[model samples]
Target: MARNPARRAALVDAAIEVLAHEGARGLTFRAVDAQAAVPAGTASNYFADRDDLLNQAGRHIHVRLAPEESALAELMDAPRSRELVYRLMRDLVARMLGDRAGYLALLELRLEATRRPALRAALTRTLRENLKRNVDFHREAGLPDDGDTVLRLYFSITGLLVEYLTAPGVLDEHELDDLVGILVDSALGIGPHHR
Candidate 1:
């Protein structure tokens, strides 16, 4: 039977809450059902198994990063795309560090999905789409359009975030901005011997 989307959404929401609050180790259908104020069987009706529930939750969180249409428009019109980009990434790093334990749980889910063939493929596809969107945003912001270049910068930033978050007091916003500023300068045709 086709499930009720509204109710399913509610369950997914509850699942995210549970995943955030309890970690993947604590997530269970009964807890989700209880969180959603539904019968255990009700959750089963929507998600037949644990992996199904997790995949849905992962997709829900993953979509939050999508850049498309109006999302791209917002990026295009922002004042000082470089600053805006740096701020956004900085804020995410701050949050990731702030709730290191909980966010680490979510990160574990992503890592676990890496070893699961089907989920890994799906994750790779989603990440590729997002990477393309991010590269396009960089081009629109007058940055270099080379995918490999943009991806390298992206990984560098993410790596810095992870390093700082894990090591504590090892990374700061000033350093992050400095690095991004260098990239922006290169991308914006501001360099010695500019043509």
Candidate 2:
């Protein structure tokens, strides 16, 4: 373990890029070092092993993908309504799409977690905590929907992101906004009878 925080962060970020493009099997100390443009042994100094690198990469991707504080504050300041929820969901999609590499790295971490118990536990904890935070935020902000709606939106958005990222042509880009609107409406139970 190296004591240099900046270098360690750099290595982990590089590891994320490697994982995103090369998959778990292609992630190695040398590969990370090359990705980071550092000396050949630099990554090994920062991480104990491949598992350590993998875990750190997973954490880093979440940090990268988290919404900006300013954006969250702006959202909270707005009137809480179904329209707000729709805007939030649209922003979520834009944010995820903006950082395709980070989301792809997260997807890769998910696949690698299936084979590594430690990684699986770590990733599960991280994701659950994130989900809890989002649910809490939605409730605290006096949003129109409950936590269940938030959870459903989370799943729907995740599936949409996966399909859009991994199989780009499968989803029509022009209809994405409409699709997100439908997901929000369905989750909030806003039908012809209800607002």
Candidate 3:
């Protein structure tokens, strides 16, 4: 409930770090304050409750991890194809892997949501908004925009990302590409074989 933007942002970022390293059970206002190297009660000052901090962490994580504008513009400028989809997936996976702790915290948030109706509803809304944004981006990039296709692609990529992030050797790039290529080809009906 504090109005200090810089301090609030730092607390939220620290919440992400605490969530990432400590999981939901370990996430606390005190932990966040400690992570941010601020005085005790700093997070409590800014957040209404644990749920508020968790929600803010989710938003911060998404912002921090979202694709760069330049990369997206490059994709938008390129020809849309299974190859492009594959590349996009690869980049997504790479980013997830690069921020393993953050993604893990997100996964924890998801699990925690399942046990709390309010959190579940909030997470669902946030996820749906993100999905809509992805679909819109796909449309703008001249990629597949069909709802079913986009939905399936979204889940598939998320699952694959989870697997890759949790267990590194589960699939090599060649294998991941092959899987993504199949999904992309199936979704958009693009690629050499589809042609």
Candidate 4:
């Protein structure tokens, strides 16, 4: 495989885009090269095979969607309240919205994992680690909710994202903030009487 970091990164990114648009079956070295606007066989030089490319693309999407340090710092500095939880969830939605293709690529990876054992294992590990990190961050921040609450929030947000991305009209865009607020409140047990 080639050792050009810049070119390799570019190819991985392009592979993400291709995966998002074309699904796992459509992902190919030639397609990746075309997506990257690089010469044919460029992706092959960097990736050992289709599985390697898919795995790399899965990792790259997470990196692309990760929260910014500044944002994390800001969240940590804020008071740990229900309101803060709402803001955090809102920020997550915004980040995913901003990188629609990255989130879409991740969804594709999840689908592809069902057929590929190696990918299934890799994705399962990565996703479990990510969930643990979020739970840890919530606890460390002294957030109002427990780790289970965080898990619930994660599932709820993922469902919202899937619906929002895959079936746009199914979810009213104007009600997104309201929907997120409801999810947070539900996860935190903030009912009408509590609020």
Candidate 5:
């Protein structure tokens, strides 16, 4: 991982760092090159433009996301699916904020990708697939066939995540957890009278 593949990986990895630290306007050849410690022309060689780089970042983020999603899915086998989801949510929040630059860049890319048809299509596919995976995670653990319930769960969480990213200062971690708990509880129909 120290040559072409390595350099490619480095620049790709640096994308979030560059975007987050530099904001949406900071995505450029020089920024990625500097962040990746590569020659200016090299990044351009791999990624011809900002859209190309952001597209790569989207793919990279998707790949990295699989493990965490799978881990959450696997933990469902432990007989504590709901608890696992809660923990996963908490961990996700921590991880998202752990590297403000990376997470912020993700948000920015997601926003801009919405304006690019190709990127938007890629995003739609990625989101749909991931949402299916998550819903399956629940189904595998005995969640009932609740029709649109899974879709609601996914988009609901997505909403929460977007709000958190856009207004990180608005809700502290505990508040976020509380908000998610409310949403999850409502989705699962958990109530004081029940549990």
Candidate 6:
């Protein structure tokens, strides 16, 4: 129903803000419209229903948080090493911290998905694809590529990021480095002092 892509994107972004601040229950067309500073009922024009808005918001968060292709390409071209792995992990943490609102909204979406079958299906598919892509990227980058290794690394980093974002000061940047180092070292089966 969205006539313009930009308008729809704006609506989605507004929906994310509303979800992050007001929680899923508070997300209404009126709330999104108000958050967007658009005319009343404007959000309804872009989305068929609240589910559509929530789904779009999920996609928007992923799109906004996805790393730039150029940055990925640069990493891909760089020499593969423990140092590079650490940098990649650091970048992920920085991105999470950089867009705390979007990440929080993403968490809200996960909670909402628990009750909405349709949303759950869509989110599950999206997350699966993301994991597959991440696995492929790691293989291409010459990093740990075994299924269990990749999954453990993924879940470990994900948990760390969620905790860090949800509760600030739980871990400082230096501590994060130590954690990342431990994870990377463990995944690679390297010693503590190694890169």
What TM-score, computed on C-alpha atoms, does each candidate reach?
A: 0.67, 0.95, 0.86, 0.96, 0.80, 0.92
Error of 5 at 116 (Å): 1.9
Candidate 6 per-residue lDDT over residues 35-130, each given as its tens digit: 999999899888999998888888789988888889877866767776787778778877877888888899999999999999999889888999
The alpha-carbon deviation from the true structure for residue 99 of candidate 6, after best TM-score superposition, in angstroms, is 1.0
- Please provide, for model 4 over 1-195, each residue's C-alpha lDDT reduced to its tens digit, 9 standing for 90 to 100: 799999999999999999989988899999999999999989999999999999999988999999999997887677889988888999999999999989999999999999999999999999999999999988978898754899889999999999999998987655998899988888998885665
> What is the per-residue lDDT of model 1 for residues 91-193, given as tens digits with 9 covering 90 to 100?
5455555555444445656776766766666667766776787787667677444456567666766676556545646655457556555654454445634
Arranged by lDDT with the best first, the candidates are 4, 2, 6, 3, 5, 1
Residue range with the least summed lDDT across 10 consecutive positions in model 3: 186-195
Superposed on all Cα atoms, the candidates' RMSDs to the truth, in angstroms, are 4.8, 1.6, 2.5, 1.2, 3.2, 1.8
lDDT of 2 by residue, 1-195 (tens): 679999999988899889889999999999999999999999988889999999999889989898899997797677889989988999999999998889999999999999999999999999999999989888988898754988889999999899989997987655888888888888898873454
Weakest ten-residue segment in model 1 by summed lDDT: 186-195
Q: Is candidate 1 or candidate 5 better by TM-score?
A: 5
TM-score of model 4 (CA atoms): 0.96
Task: At residue 195, give the lDDT of candidate 1.
Answer: 23
In order, the Cα lDDT scores of the candidates are 0.65, 0.89, 0.80, 0.91, 0.70, 0.84
Output the lDDT of residue 129, model 3.
91
Q: Which ten residues in a row have the lowest lDDT in candidate 6?
A: 140-149
Best by lDDT: 4
Q: Write the per-residue lDDT of candidate 5 for residues 96-151, one digit (tens) a residue.
A: 66655666777777777767888787777877787788677667666643666566
Error of 1 at 91 (Å): 6.3
**Residue 32 error, candidate 1, Å:** 1.9
Ranking by TM-score: 4, 2, 6, 3, 5, 1
Model 1 alpha-carbon drift over 4 Å, by segment: 66-75, 78-106, 145-147, 164-195
Greater TM-score among 2 and 4 belongs to: 4
lDDT, model 5, position 49: 78
* Model 2 bad stretches (over 4 Å): 192-195
**TM-score (C-alpha, index-matched) for candidate 6:** 0.92
TM-score of 5: 0.80
